[model samples]
Target: MGIEAELITAADLPRLEQFDGLLIRDHTRIDNYTFAFAQRAAELGIALVDDPVSMQGCSSKLRQAKLFEAHGVPTPKTLVLTRETLPIVPALLGLPCVIKEPESSFSRGVHCVASEAELVELVTALLAHTPALIAQEFLPTGFDWRIGLVDRQAIFACRYHMVPGHWQVVRDAGTPEYCEGRTEAVALGDVPAAVLASARLAGDAIGDGFYGVDVKDLDERCVVIEVNDNPNVDAGHEDGVAGPELYEAVIGTIARRAFGAGR
Candidate 1:
């Protein structure tokens, strides 16, 4: 991480073949490096953290929506709109919807719109960031929950603050915040049933380690957003269950799944 990215990217490909386990982070950028490595790794019989097929599939909002529906997980009713085919927003999910980039990371291209005028303005801003976006029905009642999965298990979970008025990680928008978030020790029953099912589906879909599943629960049906490949384990840091114990579990899971050496 300290070295220059291009240097690593330009490094010898033949040397990389010496390793038995291939982690995507070996590539400086996941989209570029991970994708390229995945294509090559498949031939070498080495498994990638998040394979090319799942990463590519989850890269597009449309594909994610299909996965959600197939798994019976409820998500915001959304439309895949390009520059040419912008759908009517209200008829699909009503006002105060969100327009976001399908492949954006770190909330880079996500916007909350309240009205038709606001929607247009938000869309304009989003296009500047990402031309391809998903217009989703807004679920303002609750903050979007991020459930981190390790080896198809919900080991860590947290809820992100859409609005800081409620329990949230960070109050400032510009700065990254790690609030001592109140992450409930939930079983599958604590979360919306559909969310757990969807989380498992996402694990199956991505078939990787360190997955962060985004789900929307309206006290009833839980909607699946997308499965993230580089999911954060800061959840333990947020809740203060971190240090050694949590770290051990994380490493143990990775050893079992990634190396095929653990029980």
Candidate 2:
């Protein structure tokens, strides 16, 4: 907490060596400059939150599917849907399933299909862009547990309620009428053990870095939806329970990694 920090932009790439660590708060994409910054930071031996490994693993649903499977992380029945296998959606995942693009975020590039007609139509449209998609068994729930983890340890846990009359957390994001549901942060100890365990498994599957694992608790069983890097830690939302300690832990981890990891 005693460290001095300053915000840097893409144009400040030359100045990267001046800092001991970099915390990337911007939207990260493999093809974007944010990832390039991470690469450069790693090259310069500067510690980074959402390291390159975490970014690569968390950016794609296809990779996550395999990662979870390899590590035995509990997740909904999922399959990689390609154009060749479009007809098997109903037979495999059934109707009312959830479809997600590999690089989807903030509820964009995701769809809920009700019937075989919808499944074919949506997957057809989506495949035109990417060769594959993710189809999973629908787990209907009122809210999702977002557990924040740093270095594979639970830091803060919160319930992200679904938007009123919507199935996802956010509705019409990136639009003028965009809206999202409420967030209630709970103490880490108060979170369900299964939920925390699922999040931990997910974090372990990914690299040991900052992660926010989304888990659904249904029928008294918890299953991970996905592992995300650079998860939101809004002022009054995720910090409601952990408060400043959460921020300090995150910052401290980055500092330690900066001075400790391969430095």
Candidate 3:
């Protein structure tokens, strides 16, 4: 793989034809330029890590909830909350539940509400941005399992501990705060069978591509939280252990697809 990769911006869309493959690393939305780039790459027959299908599938938590249920993947009880159904969320999911925007990521648009009044306030505020929201039964897991998958295989594993005094992995109050837990690389074979199976099932439900499957393990029961595309793989964080091998696996897939070395 002697291919040279260069970083390009939205301005480089016209020049994408010169590249052999396109690995979209931006926040993708159906109406955004990233989706346009994926479409362009598809039209040009260039290899893409996260094609539009994966992007759209992973971007919506609402869709993920449906997928998890349809695929028999275990997940906490969730319901789509609208202005009409907002009043019954407490009865449906109970107090101390979690509310999330449909397209939220990095735990930015998520909130833990303990009462009906609080839920209404948060949902009303968030509804200004999105049409509907998700209310889920609160599962008090101190940490969540982040299983990185490439081509439907688990490549890396870590526990994303919740921020101290917060309920989500990433805290985005007045100032955003991330987990201080060290990423521990667990061998695929060493991972819990149920967790690995659920991760694979969740990733496959989206597509065969790069994904970070978030899961919560309570006792021996494992449930899928969400599947994210273009997941973080920073130098010291996600790539702290077995950095080269992980990078090679992702790049090799892209290169092989681009060069047509193996189909």
Candidate 4:
């Protein structure tokens, strides 16, 4: 990744030009400058991956839910609400819901509420962090599967073993000793049909690139929890499963798609 990661400007883009393609991974929700350059570069045929349209959609949880649900992909119940309409969640989706900042990522501003009172408190606290919020159904499960897809095809998938004390994985809960042993990097062959359908659903929804689709098989029912365009790809543990070829294959696919096949 250290291939001269330069922070270029909007004006600089047109001035200097020598690259295969450009990928905007500056967290567009926060980086306005990068977003502007990304827009301009795409118009100039710079080959921007995760096109601005797709990035914007995946950046918001509310949009992601709508995209997934609209495609017949099963996901946790979600309701995009303003401050005034937040109170109606209990009456609509009933008690026990998750309140999260739609534009937030990595479980930074996510909370689970088991009761109406909890929901109110959590919702209030969450709203203080961001204006847009999504009240979603709590996906109950011990361990969830994070299926990684490269260009609409399954590459590597593993069960994200959650800690007993903490239900969320994105949060930095100190050492991973709190979690289970190595994450089994099961081949695409072991992926169940419904799970495959869930992955395909996300791919069709997102329509591009290396994405991590979090799917939960709760009580024999396959439901997608979230589709992450930027899924975690760390493989630095001894016990954890790390398929080197799986890793290379994704990178190759990205390069092939960005630059031609026989480059």
Q: What is the TM-score of each candidate against the true structure?
A: 0.73, 0.96, 0.91, 0.79
User: How far in Å is the alpha carbon of 2 misplaced in model 2?
Assistant: 1.7
> What CA root-mean-square deviation does each model show from the true structure?
5.5, 1.7, 2.1, 4.3
Across 126-199, the per-residue lDDT of candidate 3 in tens digits comes to: 88888888888999888888899988877888778877776777666446344544466665666788888889
| TM-score of candidate 4 to 2 decimals | 0.79
Q: Per TM-score, what order, best first? A: 2, 3, 4, 1
Per-residue CA lDDT of model 2 for 78-118, tens digit only, reads 98999877888888888799999999989998899999988
Total backbone clashes of model 2? 0
Show where candidate 1 strays beyond 4 Å: 1-13, 25-30, 83-87, 121-131, 161-163, 166-192, 238-263
Assess the local accuracy of residue 138 in candidate 2 as a C-alpha lDDT between 0 and 100. 91
* Candidate 3: residue 28 lDDT (0-100): 79
**Where does candidate 4 have its weakest 10-residue lDDT segment?**
173-182
TM-score of 2: 0.96
Give one clash count per candidate, in the order shown.
1, 0, 0, 0
Please give the lDDT score at residue 216 for candidate 1.
72
lDDT of 4: 0.69
For each candidate, the alpha-carbon lDDT, in order, equals 0.61, 0.91, 0.83, 0.69
